[model samples]
Target chain A: MLDANKTIQLSHGGGGKEMDQLIKSLFFKAFDNPILRAEEDAAKLQLSGPVAFTTDSFTVSPLFFAGGNIGKLAIAGTVNDLAMMGAQPEYLSCSFIIEEGFSIAELKIIVESMAEELQQSGARIVCGDTKVVPRGCADGLFINTTGIGRIIMPNISTQNLSTDDVIIVSRDIGRHGAAILMAREGLELESDLTSDCASLWPMVEQLIAANIPIHAMRDATRGGLAAVLNEWAKASNVGINLIEKAIPIADEVKGLCELFGFEAHDLANEGTFVIALPREAADGAVEILQRYGHCEKACIIGNVVETHLGKVVLTTPWGSHRYLDLPQGELLPRIC
Target chain B: MLDANKTIQLSHGGGGKEMDQLIKSLFFKAFDNPILRAEEDAAKLQLSGPVAFTTDSFTVSPLFFAGGNIGKLAIAGTVNDLAMMGAQPEYLSCSFIIEEGFSIAELKIIVESMAEELQQSGARIVCGDTKVVPRGCADGLFINTTGIGRIIMPNISTQNLSTDDVIIVSRDIGRHGAAILMAREGLELESDLTSDCASLWPMVEQLIAANIPIHAMRDATRGGLAAVLNEWAKASNVGINLIEKAIPIADEVKGLCELFGFEAHDLANEGTFVIALPREAADGAVEILQRYGHCEKACIIGNVVETHLGKVVLTTPWGSHRYLDLPQGELLPRIC
Candidate 1:
């Protein structure tokens, strides 16, 4: 009878034994925290001082496709975002919008993958909400993860921005973009282009431990470096000048961009970030990120400039200049 | 030049001006919070002590149908969950899973409706995330809202079920069921059987303000009152005896149940709740809830029993007894 107990079914959502099995064997096995294992309707936590809060939704298509599926992405995405602000990743609340006909086995696999990600990142999904839609309302599965991180760091930032900041990227641009192109385009490429998706908090903690005045940082997910650079420029009311040759891009991405009439710069990136640090700490920040897996290709891409307000200009390989607009709309949809 | 702006396109998810227009005209107009006004990456809040955190996803079919649409449902669903816990609804994070080829006009309408609900409920959307799927992958749109409320009341319990506790429902059953059935079944019933879906936090706050020992509470959504009752019965390790004849169900729902082979008790409800209160506080709780729009049909449907453990039985109108098992599956598949 126990051997016959199989994967999840629609009936589990019906709130029966199937639901119990899914919760016990699947969710519980993957995530077992005292607060989560309490099996309460909500999680209760005691907070002391200031808190840094963040949330994100992942709707990457082909739920179990190449690189990593939606489940792993959901955990890493929110955790990495919190880490960017140097917040200790603590409790996460998860919600799923599932289409009715999605296979239960696939759901289990995704959950298992997420479990591995959560374990490595030291985060617990304390509460979760699930909703199923008719076949049409949603893609196979869409996940929303809301994270709560305690501000253990004394001085992260309080809207402090200045002109003497150098912009540093944790890693090479377009590895995630190149990998998505290979997977989405169904290519058999010689280059081993895998997504650089991993937690950045460890690297962030290392920098914080080093006592660097990291002004502001953003994970370059959707619009890549262009979107994040332009956003920081507008927020801090400064300009960014990029040395096109100094910026990192894989040869494969450049090739793919040429084939699809797309610019590699505008493609989506998941693992890297655009960080503004003091000009003096540029060397130290670059060295720290280089030691981490996420930033093996780390480099000083550019710097926050005092001159042109709200403008991000890229120096072309030919040594001329052009204004880099925040790619008006999404380039490759749901790359995250 | 103004007329050149025609409608929403795939690029809106790409984070463009049309997306800005949609947010400014629909969302910002309704949710005017300082954090959202700045449109920053995350919402920053300064606070102390414990916080109540909750998240819910809305994946109703056709995005825009009868009674209320996805937008209002998303806002109302999260706000109501927070209210059930005796928390003051404060910050909300909204995430959207939008399908390719969805009508721009429909998306706008849903956002506007959700915004209106937020304003009415006094909750602000502090952050937002958006994702888009390919054309055949999704129906139209799905929304997930994560809610965080400051825990004003110190001690509230999900395991507060005692032998002498009374189970009180906020209002009539199956209003949302009837509305969805009409929309899906294309029935033209000449009745104002609109969904009972409004924010329930305000209704809950009115009751909590009276200083009553609220043992357990839940919004009778997806699986309805029976499921919640079953959960309480198990959590509190007690038996529940509910008289079927005393339960309040609309006449129209009863009629529809007869035709569709659906049980009035099993039908999904959107804007209702079942609260387990101290035996002494039952009368006061009922009186307070009735003063609000949600509990006009409120009643003491059942009482907690000390003898039998983890069981919920109902006395039928015909003097027969049946174990009110937790719902085994979706009653109105994807009704929410």
Candidate 2:
């Protein structure tokens, strides 16, 4: 059994009795399931047809934040990637690189958070690996989650976007970026500006259930909205014209962006996503998204156009237009 | 484009122009394939029937060893896990957590090594994620590879072992651990000892082609040969009697183990594996394995029995017997 006060040691990752005890007492107990309990080198799965596979490594600083920790982010990040491709999140493999001397209690909290987040998408941690480095060899902890799911709605790709497609914002953007910034700077914002970090699979599943013909879907993470829009435009060989005023931005995020001389559009969002679909289905998708409390502000934000191919053009509230190029510099490191 | 002289910066992982350029020029060029070039959040694969999913995080110290580097180990480690399950290594998802200020030139070498190793199994790097942390947040780099392969031989479980089953080792043990120790300790033993780091898929494919009924197969990795034997004994609820002299150990590895006061059986191996099969099929399996130069020393070293259930009993050259318990305490840190 792991002692709460005892920091992790090299022996715990030595592939011996100590490692076995730690895995069984901590990880296995937290992410328990028959597939994982099978204890095979690999988890046996009955996957068929087209499968969506994705991977993400979370090296977020200040492992824990106001609304979520690296554990929650790791799970949601990979699950959301599969969901964006219209895949039903099913099984995930989690790998952890831990720093020696890290607190056992803290690791427990992170593991529990991951278990809690997996519930939102009904995904299971079917397999995993753990490695512990000497103290200072790594920061507190980093997690990598690789996920595979069955693609229920096939052919959803960035290149599928068309000229007349409508772009929808699932929720307010920039909260995750701002929240992490605040935590790192130790700012007393005196506001409930937690990260927009939550599982988006439930809403995605509902959209699929409603038969929305999604052309392109992506979660706006690092480099945020600007990066996603620019990538989509270039990939689809179409231009995206966005109304700057129409995009949702929470007040706290806006203030933080202004104070830091940062653009809200380039700030990351963990739970928010952008969708491209036929204009006719845009309202229906928004309706389903708004049904979730967190996505109550979901609305139309832009439209795809033939002009300015391979570019994202933003129409400002002042009736001016400018190119929103892909982010070009370091905005913030380890923001998620 | 990445300049060999320039070190990796935070901007290179900021999900922006710099990050995109780095990926396209380095990772994309090395692991080029249609599936990877798809540029979606996840890779879409046509996987069918029963599949095996496994993951590993490589934090091997002294990144470069006598026989291979971390990149080779990362790919081979994950692929071998799938191969051990009688699955053909197919698709792999790679994720990297890098430390800022690390040399781009070094990273290029590692990436190229991964691409080269993938050729042995024909497994494509379909999808990946990259994150760079500020200096000192990590040692140098850590790579996580999650792999999936279709199971060609099912029911190959540790629990499948029965009384009188033959146990065979693919090659000499402890080379990997000794090589790493030499690299870290800066020792010059004037020996041709190198880590047994290699892709086992080619040899495994031949065994499968030869119709070897493997009851259980596992690569002796972190916990080494001792760990595998003990785990098998416990999992199968059967006893294993091993002939001490029959277990292969290279002279250099034995010297290093003796000098360091370590057990060769408890040291790690990147390429070595142990297989349990019916007594009648042992020779065929060994014959098939020996065809591969790396596994030329493949031979039976033990047998399953009803006595001493759930334990591994080692018979020494002098007719002495001792229980080979699971390795205890830290043998070596970051030995892959």
Candidate 3:
């Protein structure tokens, strides 16, 4: 048993007795699985065919926030990457870099949160490493999760978008970046303006099951919807005409953006995603997406066009158009 | 092209135009491959059969070290984990969490170092993520590498040791820890004492190719030789009798251990590993390992025994015997 009065020490990450105890008592117990319990340096996975491998490091400040903590975000972020690639989220590797004196109870809560989030996608954290730095050597804690999944659908790519494709927004965007900003500023907004940080595997899985010919699907993470759209436009060498009025944005998020002098399109999102597929499948994809609780505001926001190659043209409600270029400056650090 | 005069900004990790430029101009160029060039959310890999999955986060202080930098360490560490499981090093995902204002030149050097090290195992970095935190939120930069490999020799586990198995040390112990200590303490020992931080995939591949029936193999990383032997003992429920005289220790490492009041077996070894196999294969395995320049010090160090189950006993040169316990407390932080 770990002492309540004691905090994380350098010894806990030294790969010896203390590390063994910490791993067995906390990580092993929380992520109890046959593969992980095998206790080898690496996890032996029985994977076959094509697999999607992705990695992300989460250094979100204020480990706990409005909707989810870093642990939940870590699992969802990497799993979502795999899911967006039309793969079934299967296995994850969680690594932690902790600062000395970090609270054990908080660590436990964060770890439990990871286990809870893994249920959404059935992704097991099979292998992990923990390293503890001395005080002030790092922030509270940083987590890196790498995921590998079996690709159920192949060739869903950023470069696959064509002029016949219609772009759809999975949900209202910018909540994740707004929520992190609010948390950092210690804002007490009376509205339920939580970060839209949830596992996106469920919605992606549904889209795959429905046999939607998804051309490209990406979560609008750090640079938000604008980044994904711009990258898609450039990669596919097609023009994207986004209907600004049709894009979903929560009132609270808009208000925060107004106050912060930022654009909702440029804000980060954890759960929100953008999909490009043929116009015929657009309505069906939106219909399936809106069935999910978090994706109620899903709608068709844009369509691919032949003109303005490699550019995203946004038409405002006032009928004026502007190039929705890739975001340039930093909107919010550590949003994920 | 990235401006040579500018340092890394938060926008470099913001998933915006700046971030994409940084990744393409630096990471993509250094780790160039068709899969990586595709720039999908996740890398699509065609893998079959049983595979090994592993992850490691490198937060080693002094990014530049005696023998290698953090980039080399990150690649080698994760690759070695897969190799230890008798897996052929294949694909890797590298994620970087950088502090704002980190030197671009340093980053380039580190990345090139990673590319250089990848040649040892022929593993390609297939997918990655980059995040930049605000200044002071982290050290200069922390790298997390997750690897996937196909299993060549399955069921090589820490729990597979038997009384008939003999243990062999790959090389001299404690060089990594001693090197780090020397660098940190600014000790110019009039001796060429560099870290043993080379990739072990070549040696591991040779061992597998030679048809060595390796029961278990593990790198003496964070907790070093003592930790590996103790873990093998407990995991297999077999006693290990170690010949202290036969365990190779460099003179400089011995001097450092004496000066720091530490045991050589308790210090970290980045490139050294221990192998447990049947006594009949011990000489063959050692010969194969010694063919490599770094593994010149390879020798048999111990043998599994029936007495003192789950314990490691050391026989000293003077005929004195003692229990070699698993390391406890903070031996040295960030020795990796």
Candidate 4:
């Protein structure tokens, strides 16, 4: 017996049998392809070379928020994920779950935004799909982007980051987070803070070109410096020692964070990077990044250590210490 | 001064400048990877040897439609595309566009369905992104999946299609299209004619192992025979002469099509395939494909020819003649 649920409910997209039926009877019926035909767990392509792959999802509210909207966020988010692997972003596939009755005009805007962003990142949106649910089934707009990029500098190592590695941030922190907070909470902030949203390739290309002996690089996004530091610690099986005084923060953002009882260290900043490099090449890499106008506010944020596995401590300006942990609850939902 | 209307639009997805802003400000910021960092159009990767890349989109309406949902469709569509290329579908990247108020349960279901289908196809869901739009901004769900596969068959070739190529079908046509018509138009055809929605790789694998001199293969999906034949015709730079009587048709589907004034040939069919092979290997290919439970009814319907430059003509049972052109107007909206 066929039942008609007039509007979409969360259960429909739950990846269950009902969803499977929808695909088998409807979607799979329309477009047929081999990759989809295999029904594999992960698409496995026999590649003759080493490559990089990345994926990201956007659950941000205010489909169009301050700094950057969901459209821009969707493409950049995945592209950057692949880039973090030191892989040159290449082809992208876009998928959309459009809630019924969504304004086509606005979708056009977002699609246009996505197209332009893809161009800047130098990626082609070769293939994609679109589905529509009835009204009240989802938030205004939610987008997911998955990208494939070819690894260019295979020798630029990341699987090995050890002690004596210096952690460098491309610029001052708190811009993106502060912008989001201001926009969401309607708080009056002193600075004209905009998200530092830009392609990192310009800066990364220079670093790779300069032959910097870097261990790893990461974008300081949600959960901010602390989250990124923890990941590095785990990925490289090492420890981190951060110097609070050396970390860069714009005075405007710093003042606002303090007023709001927020920690500056935990703020999210887009288009900024934290790179772990050998002590010897740290200075030179920072210098090279600065020339590209990406890291004008570059600074030595911290250094790696041999002791204290999987732990991070931040020394405060008042000469106090605080244990750093991944942000538990989302401070801002869809900041990126 | 923060003119929100100056905000981004959807045209960005079309590939342009505003799209650049979206990528820079949102996507790259979230996922900072090396390959994505390169930001190149149609990413060029060093040959990993041989590769398979395919893309497909989901624009199904009634997001909770019958048979399979968008999530499962996303996975199956791309997998099938890759398989048609003779590639073992491996990696997949999905992009989602969700509308406001879409139940989280539905999203979860779709994701879960994707996971299940991927497992069935022997692929995995590696990376994905999501975006949300305002209420009434979009349908409940839309998905785009791009799959990459490994070309294990080095000698397998698309260029091998030659004159005297015998055609074989994986299954009967019109089930998918007929089911959709019944569901969409509220037509009651008294029969349990469900869509033939099952992965074809198992059968194709048998065919490949049998070592048939397969020239070309395509999933007869949207535009049905019209779409695939047109594509093959243009690609092979040849004509296809089809025997209308030889094409299999279920009585129920035929009756339903007559009632709706729909051409069975142009109706979308999900679980069917058109394969071309040398005359010598036709029987072998058909025999192997028929070994599968669903494909036991597989039969020969047409052949390839050198003349007629991209034209498909059919010889009816009554010896009448008709030229088949790709359907111009929208035949079925959101059928898949």
- The candidate scoring highest on lDDT is 2
For candidate 4 chain B, the 10 contiguous residues with the lowest summed lDDT are B1-10
Docking class of 2: high
RMSD of each: 2.8, 1.2, 1.5, 10.7
Between 2 and 4, whose TM-score is larger? 2
In candidate 2 the C-alpha lDDT for residue A286 amounts to: 96
Model 4 over residues A1-336: C-alpha lDDT tens digits?
113334333233333344455445433433234554444223334455667766555666566655676777777777776677677776665566666556655665677677667766677654444444456555555665667777766544334678898889889887777877777766544456666666676667777778887677778776678777876786677778887888888787787788787876677766778888889998898888778664788978888888777777777789887777766544554565
Residue A57, candidate 3: C-alpha displacement in angstroms = 0.2
Q: What is the lDDT of candidate 3?
A: 0.91
lDDT, model 4: 0.67
Model 2 pairs whose backbones collide = none
Q: Per-residue lDDT tens digits of candidate 4, residues B120-188?
A: 567654444444445555556666777777765544433455678877777778777777777666654
Q: List ranges where model 1 is wrong by over 4 Å.
A: A1-9, A64-66, A134-137, A152-161, A328-330, B1-7, B62-66, B318-320
* Position A106, candidate 2: lDDT: 94
User: Candidate 2 residues B172-254, lDDT tens each?
Assistant: 99899999999998884577888999999999888888888889999998879998988889889999999999999999989
| DockQ of every predicted complex | 0.53, 0.90, 0.82, 0.15
Query: What range of 10 consecutive residues in model 4 chain A has the weakest lDDT sum?
Result: A1-10
| TM-scores for candidates 1 onward, in order | 0.93, 0.98, 0.97, 0.74
Best by DockQ: 2
